[model samples]
Target: MNYIDNDPRLQTGKPAGIDKISIWIHPFLIREPSAFHPSSGNNKKVILRYTSRNGFSIDFQAEFFDPFKNIFIQILEYLIGLSIRGILKSPINKDFSTVEKCFCTLFTDLFAIDCIEFYFDFMRGHLILSNITNQKYKTTRYSNNYTREGKSVIIAYDRIERLKYVNQMNYDEISSIIYPMRFEFKLNRTNCEYLHPTNIFGNYNVIFDNYLIFLAKRWRMYNQQVVSIPVLNNLYYAEKFKTIIQYSQWQFPYSMMNLEKTPSCPMPNKSVKLKDIDRNWAVQFSLKDWV
Candidate 1:
């Protein structure tokens, strides 16, 4: 999703009438050669390029939403998807309806969905919900472009060009050439519907708390397994960008949250079997083992 232009109306206490929905949703993939990429300008011939299932094919008119909105949507969606898969601990094949029901309940209750146009951001991520029924009342014109809070978060992905690795962050802090978002399914024009990946970050600490539990459990199951967010290699870096919380305490710049230590398995003490004068034999056997 792209930011088309800065509106003075936003300062004048008027609705910008600009679409900002793209800011919330980010797809799972980043398109090569960004919209502003030198090559992108040259390729603006208005030809019908087959839009990726998750990418937009609109002629980005200045009056229309900005191209940046497109990029923003793409990145936001990707982060959401990752959180669903990684944090919510949901499986991929779960029914879309069930996922949507759970998502709306959790997100709306937690973040106040009535005030936020997350679907627009989801669209940016190239995630299309098959059923738009849930999003019916949210499609206002200018309201789509701006949030009451002037500031917003962006999921700047890493290694989008090479691999699908990413780091969640605010827009101002991202430095790498990354896609704004990635979508789970390929784009389909006929249906024109999609849903975003379930995301965990953004103002909510519950996701972080849940992640800690998941991580600890996984670690307990297999201690040697590497616990990595890849992008969060160092605590200093995370602090600089204010990225997601790092699992390792040493890697966190601020006071990292501490998890309750897992209790150890208890060992049982043996009781003598009082059978047929077997006390002497049992004592002798136990003593031999100890010896």
Candidate 2:
């Protein structure tokens, strides 16, 4: 995946293209008093709040690779394969392009899927998706008026049965069924700097190089997990694992200095394993040091 030069034709905040997807870090994640904590379960509860002023929005024009889209497709296909093989019974007939469109609709109609708004549990080494809600509004300047709109829903990651049913339905039905739940959680009011980990400033090449290394490490760790898609209930196989590894490496090359060796993972199986990174080797060395 070579980086595409900025196109003047792209409107101010539109996605770069099919190849690019941006991840936004939530303001809460980097705040001085971070809402996230390793110990407290309540603190860890993920809540996505949308208001008229700032409905959930993630800017991806800066970073082009679409990890969310890639991972979503991988999981969707894996689920479909399971259904076809008799492990599960879900109707999945759509091609990659159709499924991709469905995913975009999910973001636009129901909830935002940008990296920033969601909580990334770094300590646990998995991404977490939780309940999402729309904020109610009240205005009292001229006259007392109150209005509440938008839907809320809790996506239970542990409930594979519910997800299976969802995968079987069309986009409209899925949206209608999943978009409404009560918004009950409290919002974090603390202010903080929004630093998307991948968007660190400096030389463009250096930042991209470091970002790729970070993504590779994270993806490898994610691939090694027993449950597929971590917080989401889906199963993955050897072939799909290979596809993920290849896709990540292809999108972000670890090194331009040397092309002799690249990141590699073992075949995906019941007992699949990830190779350890060698700090001493140029190929495995962290780009952070040089950057």
All-Cα superposition RMSD per candidate: 24.4, 23.5
**lDDT of candidates 1 onward, in order:** 0.25, 0.27
Off by over 4 Å in 2: 1-172, 175-210, 226-244, 247-291
- Runs of candidate 1 with Cα error greater than 4 angstroms are 1-158, 162-175, 178-203, 219-234, 239-291
Q: Write the per-residue lDDT of candidate 2 for residues 150-241, one digit (tens) a residue.
A: 21111112222243343654556544432221111011111111222223322333333334343333454333321223522221212222
* lDDT of each residue in 1-291, candidate 1, tens digit only: 112124333221111111212221111111221321212222232211223431322222113222223432333343345334442222244444544443343332111100111111111222222222223222211111124534211111112321322334434444342232221111111211121223223221332342343333322332222122333233221231122222432343222433222222111112323352212433322223211
Lowest-sum lDDT 10-residue window in model 1: 112-121
Query: How high a TM-score does candidate 1 get?
Result: 0.18
Clashing pairs for model 2 are: 20-64, 21-66, 24-115, 24-116, 25-116, 26-116, 152-181
Best prediction by lDDT:
2
